[model samples]
Target: MRANKGLAGLIAGDTAISKVDVSTSSLWYRGYDINELCEKTSFLEVAFLLLCEKLPNLKEFQEFEAFERAHRDIPDSLYELFKTMPSYSHPMDLLNQSVSILGSFDEKNTLGSNSKEENLRKAMRLLAKMPTVVANSYRLSQGLTPVKPNKSLSYSENFLSMITGTETKDPLSVKTFDTSMILYAEHGYNASTFSARVTAATLSDLYSAVSTAIGSLKGPLHGGANEQVMYMLKEIESVERAKDYTLKKINRKEKIMGFGHRLYRTGDSRTAVMKKLGKALATKLNIHIWHDISDIMEATMIEEKNIYPNLDFPAASAYYLLGIPIELYTPIFAASRITGWAAHIIEQHNDNRLIRPSCDYIGPNARTVEPISKR
Candidate 1:
């Protein structure tokens, strides 16, 4: 059998969660289109749809929101633990540690005996608390007081408020942030989601599985791409210089972050919605330089290499314009993606199997071990 490096096109297993359709460059959660969700629903509602397989009704949404709000305040010990961690540690690492620590706090943290209800409870707790963990970690690292969640704000607004330590009374910014979250809520078997599933297939508890996913998403090639994209845009510095910089990179055969996606040959469908939001923010905030530079780079890349920007491309500038710190990008991704990761874990547990795949051996035939002393 022919081997596929990175298992590029291999269908390892079935999932009824999300689909990434290459031909259309579309993403869907359950049966709903990503664009529709982004435009029509709040992130809390989208999270409900992802985790529960249907959009929440008024009563159900109220219940979900209440549960989420009630769990928003993480243990004070977690914040103290953050102080002991090195300030220079990547925020993703801190977030992963938080998840592991959260598992320890749960008396029912175990494998196998987790009923659907139990798993849902765990998912809700993580979903509610992850944004707080992310926001507080950043605040502590900056030598600032950690901001508590404001239940008065919506889920997306509360998260932004926690990070900024200001109430996001602005409707537009909150809406844009919520849109980003909905767009990011899920994709079919991305690296991090796959990692979560692999861990779950081993009969691990929900927290362990999610922690595994967070570690995987921390890699630059995955969730970190948006941060890299922002760095790249800043490096370009000017709209006039963007073309030269991008073309030089292309000539050098260097990989450009956020320019292309594996699943979308035409383009990322999420790009349009994000790009629109980015443009609106740039215009309103009068921080048009980043967006203009992005436009130039995007044009140059497509003209030179026919590559289109993924969702991460536009998302970087939008987040920057929103006054977010660059280091917090991937953590934001994690906060949004937690819903998707939880959904996959639940699905994996529903019909569990060990996700073990064999690799072809290309080393010396029948090699024998030698004694250390002989060597």
Candidate 2:
């Protein structure tokens, strides 16, 4: 018997965290529409909505932000550890290692009961620290000193500052970055979230679950697609060559980096928000070439293959124009996605069950193996 390949279209389980409606090509965090959140809510607000199951009022948000700010700094030992990782290590691996080491350092993260409150505390810790880890890891690998986190900046602005070594307070840039975080903050039971839930189902600690999720997100088919999108555009280089280059890839049956998604057949709902942000940034910065190349490629693909661009397509260029390095793209994805991962982990542990599944055996009817000498 043939098993379902990659479990496509299979209903693995239920979640109240987010809704991915392929029928309408829409995504919702809890019940809030993603587009609405991107437009009207800050990233922290979206994250709060995901974790708390309701939108926070101004007073609640201020308290939450202050609490998160208190935990933003990783231990100095972690900074020393970051200095020791080989310069060749992938930034994602560094992040995973950092989380693991952090678990060892924080008793609350490792030894606390799997209560909702405890999980929320740990989630806030991870959310506050991940940006610092990612930024400092990238900087340390570049032989540069790590920058300290600023308490006065908002979450999105602080992350931009840490990575760029300059305070990020521009309204448009902060808005675009915040919107990207909100767009990426969560999706219903995507690969990384599923990995997180599965690990949580085993009663593992939060850090292990998050580390596993990070490993899952590092795959090219998932979070890394945005990084690959930028690489593709850099190769094409100009609008004049965009269509021919894309067509050539199609002719050779090469997989395009950011065209189709598993869930959305027509278009990713998040794409429009990111595309708009990218266009605004491009125009604002007077850097139209990336946007021009993207437009031609998008038109070419839609006309030739009927494939629409996903969020990654525009996000790659948007982050590029924001002065972000390509290597940090997925880590930035992780920085936002930790909120979703934490929410799912809490949900799974609240309604705990083992997630074991079966597979069909097809090798020689399961005959006994021969001894090594006889073979």
Best-performing candidate as measured by TM-score: 1
For candidate 2, write residues 1-375 as lDDT tens digits. Answer: 343788787888888999999999999899989998887889999889999999999999998899878788988987888788888888999999998988778776654367898888889889999999999998888788889999988998899999888898988888888898998889888899999999999988888899999999999899999999999999999888998999999999888998998889999999998999889998899999998999999998899999999988999999999998899999999999999999999999999998988886566655678999998
Q: Provide the lDDT at 46 for model 1.
A: 90
Segments in model 1 whose C-alpha atoms lie over 4 Å from true places: 367-371
TM-score of 2: 0.96
Candidate 1 Cα deviation (angstroms), residue 87: 2.0
Candidate 2 ranges with C-alpha deviation above 4 Å: 1-3, 110-112, 365-375
Question: What is the TM-score of each predicted model, taking all chains together?
Answer: 0.97, 0.96
The residue pairs found clashing in candidate 2 are: none
